[model samples]
Target: MQPASIDKQINNYLPQVTVNQKKAVLTVVKTFAEQDENEYSEEFKKELDSRYDEYINGGKLVSEQQAKKRIKKIINGKSK
Candidate 1:
């Protein structure tokens, strides 16, 4: 009845399933997940659109090297 038990049961039967059966199961899971009723607010959508437009219109963007350096600093717990 628990999630872990269900996961273990599914894992046990996975090896016996064909590739097509696995694909079918994945499709069904995706369909079920896509049925979520959550909706973003209009203000949030507008903020996203504004940010996207700014990025498209040559807004200041970090270079790949800078991004990697920032990520490494965060991972190493070093403050700027």
Candidate 2:
């Protein structure tokens, strides 16, 4: 589906959500809007999955909250 369609669906659901839910939904919308198709190709996903597995195998396992923090850190650490 098109980005506009996705945005419309998400916006339709956002108003009835809690504040935290709104923030999360907006963040998802922003990320989807920002991504480039080529930048998120299948090869890229496979490599990222491999890296995540390596991190896990290296004893870098974290709780859900910790994982979220580290994921943002890792994403921000990359040079876009």
Best-matching candidate per TM-score: 1
Give residue 38's lDDT in candidate 2 (0 to 100): 34
Choose the strongest candidate by lDDT: 1
Cα RMSD (Å) between model 2 and the true structure?
A: 13.1
- State the number of backbone clashes in model 2: 0
- lDDT for residue 43 in candidate 2, whole number 0-100: 89
For each candidate, the alpha-carbon lDDT, in order, equals 0.91, 0.83
Stretches off by above 4 angstroms in model 2 are 27-80
At residue 76, give the lDDT of candidate 2: 90
TM-scores, one per candidate = 0.45, 0.32
Worst 10 residues of 1 by lDDT: 32-41
lDDT of 1 by residue, 1-80 (tens): 99999999999999999999999999998887776546677898999999999999999989999999999989889653
